[model samples]
Target: MNTAHSLAPSQVSNKARVLLPGARLGLLGGGQLGRMTALAARAMGYRIWTLDPQPDCPCAQVADHQLQASFADDAAARELARACDVVAYEFENVDLRLAQTIEQHGYLPQGSHLLAVTQQRLREKHAVAAAGVPVTAFRAVRTRRDLAAALAELGLPCVLKTTRGGYDGKGQWLLRSTADAARVPDAVFHGDAAVEPAGESDTALEAPLVAEAFVPFVAEVSVVVARTAQGDVVSFPPAENVHQDGILRFSIVPARLPQEVLRRAQKAAERVAVALDAVGLLAVEMFVTADGRVWFNELAPRPHNSGHYTQDACSTSQFEQFVRALCGLRLASPRLLSPVVMANILGEHLPAVMRHLPAWPGDAKLHLYGKAEAKPGRKMGHVNVLAPRLEEALELLRTLQVWGPLDLPAPRLSS
Candidate 1:
């Protein structure tokens, strides 16, 4: 049996009615992504019900109803399903059992199949490759011997990552040599990424670690694509991304790449969504190599950090598209309104951002998540600077010096 196959879209959407205004959107997880999506839903006159452990979570702040309960609480999960018309996910780390329960009790348009595959690196990779998208060569390592064998097969300078939950580079380590491999704890092979997850249950210890060949990527880009249950699809322009200390810091729109490469990135993203038979948003991250090939990196089946620019620069925000996809509505145009530079406001940069708030540029749009605490490396908010030209926007960010300069100027955009 093909492990990557998707249930037919017709089966998923046949019973779907156009969720009119006043519909209750059940949001799973309540980070900034949830908050933003909730805001979009409200703009369309839809009420939101958010389930998260934090009573004052960012999403809950805007949602019409807040269910402050643990994600593991089956009772609360059922309650959220029964109380809302459509339930959707905000992040990718949702428990499969929780999603399954929601699907059984509520209308989860995007089923748990993608979650089951994407929960683990091994399965996500298999699904992406099976979809005919190119990905870095990888091997599954469940034991120390598997690690050694995978290293031998892929060679040094690879990446060793836990198959389970980790974001912002938590579960991944760049293995430059055998010494690096030796540094990874044996527990990692057993499903603990050694990155110290908050709880044992947070780790998907049943799955193995994935040892992936490190690609010498020239640039990293992501495309946010949406598909409706009725088979409609649309992709936003690719955003060039830069990561610092394993966390994303910047996403530049109209990625300064060859036109062909940009098109390839969107096509690859659309391919993944079609192959997955996705019914909502899917963010496909890819690497543009020196050879001009765009290789699949990973995926997020919800709104992505890289697509944040769409909130300010596109004709339709990704959050709105996400809402549309969930309700089986016709997708709005994803036309680029301007070249934009989206810089993340890490906790370290929050003070400076606050200091300059009054002086923030007219062309810049600020979005801050209502988190009560701040620490180094935590994503506090983001600023999207728009301009007629990409260079002007990037230069504006440099002048602010809030986070320093763009990692690398897009050669063509600079010219």
Candidate 2:
């Protein structure tokens, strides 16, 4: 028996299940991703329920029922699985053991193993490399001695990241020289911090670390792929990503790269989805070097920020595609309907964004996640600008003063 085949839904004694409209879909997270997914599921005639510590989480605003509990609470996780026909998760940092417990209660199409592999930096890199994808040089750092050895091997300007529980530029420290190493704790490098209640422990949480050699890349791009239990797969057009201080700030769809390069990225993403037997949306991020080499950067096994452009550019958005895949419906076309650029609205931009909201061009669409408070670096929402040509859309995005500036200009779009 092939292990890969066994991992899929077919191996289960129970036959493949299709969740029709009006079924209660359970989500493990209630952030913006869950909110958008819930909205899509509701439009397709499905009732949505979610488990989130915050009763008024973004998803709670749209879901039929909200189980107010921590993600690590096994009892709440089990209750959520029991209440819904099938279970899915928006975020990847969910407790691995809790997900396994939920699996015992009901359907979790994406599976717990995929979650386990993605939640840790070291595991994700190893998994991607095993799939025959190229990745940057990296080493697991578990002690001060290990960090010293890794730095000696990988060199200065390396990035030390927690093995688990970090996102949006958090839980990362850049060591540019020997002086920077002093700031990182010896215990942090060793993953010796005790796990605390509510998943909070130390100033820099105790978790294994991975020190990676930073690559000088010309562009960052991502491919979003949707896969189903039946092995059907479809990929959205690649998106060129721009980041500020490690946080994604903008994404340009139909990334201005050679057709051959785009094809390579797409194919690699499809291979990754198959290797993981991923059952929903999987976003594979890659780096394109100045020499035209593409290297795997990371993975998000759910609707990604880069794919947010699909909401206005494609016939089927990534969020809706996630819903379709979760419900066992046939995957829809991810073909681009128009050239577009999407800008993430950080908390700092909220005031300006609201002031200029009514003045935005008719082709520009703004989506605001209903977060109660706006803090610096928090993803409040986003704006998608559409046009007949990629350059036109990018030009419109560049002109949006509300976003401050397009700091890293796209070489192809820059005049």
Candidate 3:
């Protein structure tokens, strides 16, 4: 399936009534994404429940009911389903069988089928290609021999990735040459490392990986599209993404792309949403080639790391749209209200950087996740700067990241 444009206006508002306001919304996983989603649902008069192993999870702090249990605990799953009207997940690593147990009693928008396909790189890629979207050529690797064979097929400078449970550049390796290709198995798992995750239970050590040809792209962009059970669909403008150390550093609205290429990316995202009958948000990541062709890179079947900018930049954030669509509410008008840029605060130490934030204009929006501890590469919060010109917003953001003082320029805002 290719990312094509076949969105019907009616499909834009097809949520089920079971997830309406006043209903207890059950969310699986409790990270910053869940915290944001819970915050939106609570603001709209919805009661929220979540099951997370961490009792002090950020989402748990705001939810109406928080169950401290593992995703694999059948008792926890049953309790979660019985206590809520609809069930949802904030992340993609959810177990399909466990999710199915919840769906037997409640609702999982996009449902088990979509989750099953999306939780694996191989399946997600195949599904995207089946929908008519162009993707980098990939082959599955089940054994060390399979890795060697795939290398021969896809060639060097390719990506070797776990079919399931890989995200944010984790569970992936780059095979630069034949020597590197020969070392795939050890890089994937060796002796004690292979058995290290036995306690996690949810992570399978034996799952196969997929080797894919790496595309040389000019920029990375993502499209957040929403669909309802009634079949209506709408996609927001593509957001340009930049990564530092494999973690997303910032997301800018109104990606600086050729108009035609932007249209292609948006259309491809719409196609995937419609084909999968995906309800709620689907973030389609794409690679824009030098020749201007937008190739489908990956898909996140939930609110994405990139769309976090929508919270302060657009008329409707992805969180609100997700809640509205899941509750069968009329889709809100998604209009761009400003030219904005979002910079992620990765470590807890960044709060020290806040001393310099005062230099930024008052119009800039900063949001901090209520995380108790700050660790390296941990997403702590984000600062969003808005201006008529994207460059001005970016400059103000750059100032926030500088280590020491300098003669920073004044920020200009348009009337």
Candidate 4:
């Protein structure tokens, strides 16, 4: 592990500087992102402390210490601040008042303001639009009258989402006709069949909502940008993503698109990071049209699932870039080491995936979260398949077919 530089003028009794290695880093959320980030920080000779309600969460399993408490626990929040030199967030669902307490300590570089913007659909879209990035047509809906008006304005085949919370396709409704828009403002209910998916699990059922024009986009892509407080930014390779039921199914590197589309997507993502004046890592999700124009979709200010392939296929992994960016170290080169296809392993599919693991290819890298039990639709782990040719990687992935979207299917072993 490279120290690079040491803490300034070490005190005889006590010394701590978040800028250098050997300092304790407190992670706010303890899912797989925290788990991976902690692993990276530990490899760099830094201590890890995770704060999450789950005592045995994936991140806590690897952390040096764990603060087992809800995000609403102020005492635990302060304890984390006092114990660690710096704090970084692994997720965006931190409580509002608790964020105020943590921000008072000055360790949170990407403050509550960023959270406030991303937590709400309307504000996020406005910020992206203000950054001169193109976004789909949208309108705010408050009452039943407002819902009717928005549907009339944006038309059917639009999406109605809660302004706050709701992630990974939950807490949203796709209205294709007057019937879908019938009950609104007072309450919006959905059948299991009517639910649209999102990237996270924040279903803010009671919060206000926003309506957006449904885009007939050909592909969805994301770029993970790492920026320091000094404005230095490095955007990772744009990944073509596939989502079903509102959850990411897989992320394909060297996206099967024209070179011009890839270049513009990366540039557009960087522009949004600059526009938001973001520090740390920001994953920018965008919709790329057939004509090569890029449209902003959403932002996740943390290590994103879309960039998971970087761990096995990039010169510098997103986790390492995360630590470097937060600690003010020089950014690493975002070069692709090989073509990769990262596929998510959901809970229901874990058994089949494990059964075939013994036959996996030499270059296939598997990462499983330390989750106790597997539930339907829960993200358990992911595998990254790397090959000399991108097509070869895709073919290799196809052979392991427990996971599937429209193009990919379940694989069966030869008898």
Query: For each candidate, what is the lDDT?
Result: 0.84, 0.84, 0.76, 0.79
Give the per-residue lDDT digits (tens) of candidate 3, residues 108-208.
66677667767767667878988999999888776687777888888778988877677778777888988877765565533221212222233332346
lDDT by residue (1-415, candidate 2, tens digit) is 0011224555332324799998999999999999999999999999999999987999999999999999889999999999999899899877777778778999988878778777777767877888998999998877777888889999989988887777887778889987787789776755553222222223342348888898878889999988887877888988999888889998987788787778888888888888877888899999988777789989999999999999999999999999988888988888789999999999999998888777788889988889989999999999999999988887887777787655656645112
Best by TM-score: 1
Clashing pairs counted in every model: 0, 0, 15, 12
Residue by residue across 1-415, what tens digits does model 4's lDDT show?
0111222232111211237888888899899999999999899988999889987999999999999999888898888887887788888767755666777764766666667667667778888899888999988776667778888998879988877667788777788997878854345422222223223334443237788998777788899988776667788888889888889988998887777777878777777777777778999999877677778888998899999999999999999999987777788888898999999999998998989999987878999998988998999999999999987888888788676533742222122
Output the lDDT of residue 305, model 1: 95
134 Cα displacement, candidate 3 (Å): 0.2
Among the numbered candidates, top lDDT falls to 1
Give the higher-lDDT candidate: 2 or 4: 2
TM-score of 1: 0.93
TM-score of every candidate relative to the true structure: 0.93, 0.92, 0.88, 0.88
Count clashing pairs, candidate 2: 0
**lDDT winner between candidates 3 and 4:** 4
Off by over 4 Å in 3: 1-15, 185-207, 348-351, 358-360, 402-415
Candidate 2 regions exceeding 4 Å error are: 1-15, 190-207, 411-415
In candidate 2, which residue pairs get closer than 3 Å at backbone N, Cα or C atoms, i.e. clash? none
Candidate 1 lDDT over residue span 122-171, tens digit each? 77887899989999998877777788888999988899888778789988
